[model samples]
Target: MADNTAINIENIYKKYNALLEGHFLLSSGNHTKFYLQSAKVLEYPQIAQKLALSLAALIKEHSIEVECVCSPALGGILAGYELARALGVRFIFTERVNSEMMLRRGFQVTKGEKVLICEDIITTGGSALESAQCVAQQEAKIVAFAGLANRGFCKAILPNNQKGNEGSKIQAQSPICKLPLSLPLFALANFSFDIYPADSCPLCKDSIAYKPGSRN
Candidate 1:
């Protein structure tokens, strides 16, 4: 079972609210009542240290025997580094190269190595899945996954029972049978379609001021 110490959903939310800003379209494409500006926390070494400690404690408690830690580039980079430090292991990240996410810059995962995938947040699990795929290509075993906030969607569960490939493709072989967070899954599609291109967005149609969402 996963440890509960690192999965502080409530504190994560409070910290998020403190850092969030104006109307934003999340990567999930949902109009969020809240946005998790992870960079705010990442930028503060003290806060980032605190979070890293929590994640390290959880790894110890769970006895997760991972050889390496991996995360998607950008948002997951900081957290992944912290977790790796806590675990005393090597850390690597996958990045989008020419529109596809892959492990570049000579990053290698030896076959049969145990890997723990981490993320800052999981809205649709797209980026994380891509990183997982890269790991799979190296024939590594993804022992488990960690995230600061799960936001209720199960990347393990597809909308139509479709199997999502963990590494090669964004499909899963089975519903995530195990996830640390316990929240109801609300389809991103169920929320109002508030996202729009610069010119065609409904917010623009109504003259609502737009705030730039984070690209990192």
Candidate 2:
């Protein structure tokens, strides 16, 4: 993939029918004009392999040494495993046990191990951060974060901020993301969609918000 990966991402998403356009109720409780169902694209093993190799190339180009790939559970498992295969590294994952990220199933990371957090999509970076925190608890060094798609949300504030009302928590991804004005969010492509609060959402006015995610 080239430096500008968004075009390639768009092409792949379209090819795999991973991109959906409509009034969507996101997992975050916000609304958006578009949704990226990455599972559609990754469902094919051959397709997933190709995408992971592309991401591995990007990681090599950056000279970042990743000893292993760790992903947040459920969604990130396939991508992370494929990426680890491409990178020739070990793989492990963190899952939500009681809504908190935990390394169960006898998974363990060694101290000072260089780790890369992988995800299918990164929107708020909260889940990725939680997984990273899990790695940190093992004294593992978080090299960086990689995702198949980055929703490109680094800065901006909303009254419905799910994490907290902490005003400046958005800019922390600065050092982490190579995308324009985003952090730690290395992705195969970037996506930016207009999200809205419920009261101000135009879809809510039309009474046609559709929940299109598997979790729902």
Candidate 3:
């Protein structure tokens, strides 16, 4: 039988050696000692299903309605597809063409259609935000964001802006992710690591930092 128990995402990464401790570059143009290569754990279909199912359960607990799941292409495709399958919702992805994220392949979102953005891992949620923009351009409503793991720059559940309107921005923050604070981010676990910008990266003083994940 399939294991339906709660999963410890960190442990899974450890088991697969997906968690690495070293100076590395992130897609967000930040440097960190630790890197989570979710592909290592997700390469196994069974494990991917289990993880996706758990994420789906978390989303449903919030009573959030989603008609579709959209993920940034390349890194998020597997996790997104698995999540969509678990949620019984359709899945589509956005790809970068000429340095801009576009929704190609004849995919379409109806006006105000509810969508949930999924990612394998969210560092500063840059890619996810780009995907959200694509959905927003289609006039679809982004209900929430989900990821397998969070880098802990932001909390899993964002604060309430009950008095705010649709175009309101996150208050009291410099906007690392650029995602609105009103939209909650759901993740299985929070992986807290020290992140530094390229200019001030301490690791760059001696060791060379390499871009590990897909994205410039």
TM-score of 1: 0.67
Q: Write the per-residue lDDT of candidate 2 for residues 1-216, one digit (tens) a residue.
A: 422332367778898888998899866677888988888988999888888887787777667799989998878899999999999999999998777889999999999999999988877676778898998999999887888876767542212212332332433443333333332445665577778766689877767788876456
Question: Which segments of model 2 are wrong by more than 4 Å?
Answer: 1-7, 155-183
Model 3: residue 2 alpha-carbon error in angstroms: 10
In TM-score terms, candidate 2 sits at 0.80
Which pairs clash (backbone N, Cα, C closer than 3 Å) in model 3?
none
Q: Which one wins on lDDT?
A: 3
Q: Candidate 3: deviation at residue 60, Å? A: 0.4
For model 3, residues 1-216, the per-residue Cα lDDT tens digits are 223355778789999999998899888888999999988998999999998988887777678899999999889999999999999999999999998999999998999999999999987888999999999999999999999987766547421221231212222334576666788787777777889989999999989998778774
Q: Whole-model lDDT for model 3 versus the true structure?
A: 0.83
In candidate 1, which residue ranges exceed 4 Å CA deviation?
Answer: 1-21, 155-216
Error of 3 at 75 (Å): 0.6
Worst 10 residues of 2 by lDDT: 156-165
Instruction: Write down the lDDT of every candidate, Cα atoms only.
Output: 0.59, 0.75, 0.83
Counting clashing residue pairs in each candidate, in order, gives: 7, 5, 0
Error of 3 at 128 (Å): 0.4
